[model samples]
Target: MSLPKELHSSKFEQYMESIKIMYLIDDRFKMICDQYCISKIKAERNKQKSEKYLYQQLENENLSQELEEEILFYIIKNM
Candidate 1:
């Protein structure tokens, strides 16, 4: 199967294969992956914003970390 576009250059790069497998077989995992991607994109955009948007960047970072942890947990559990 082709690599998921969302997994490219992500923090979970090392877990690409596992993620691809889970993403296909597990709908919840897919949603988490999509959310993670969206969070990363928002964080990147927030970086270009003014200081007023600092909180948004921080929120996105936190969400990203939480999602990463959840993904890792799922992978480990399934493995």
Candidate 2:
């Protein structure tokens, strides 16, 4: 998703990185489990916890007001 126009370049990049990392980790776990028939409940739980922390950390940063609102909505919806 595109970030708000008001976000600083660095902050926008950081936010993208944060989201990307969560996506990477989550996708990797899902792929591994699906392909290998591995137990995934524990890994899924751990990933959820980590993603929540990442979301909170991103929210705590100097995000643009619009991006902050969007992020909050995403976090709440996911939870």
Q: Which candidate wins on lDDT?
A: 1
Best by TM-score: 1
Error of 1 at 26 (Å): 0.5
Listed per candidate, the RMSD to the true structure in angstroms reads 22.9, 21.2
lDDT of 2 by residue, 1-79 (tens): 3322333245447566554454456767435434433344456778999999999888867467778899999999999
TM-score of each: 0.50, 0.30
Worst 10-residue lDDT window for candidate 2 reads 1-10
- lDDT values for all models: 0.81, 0.60
Residue 59, model 1: lDDT of 89
Off by over 4 Å in 2: 1-39, 63-79
lDDT score, candidate 1 = 0.81
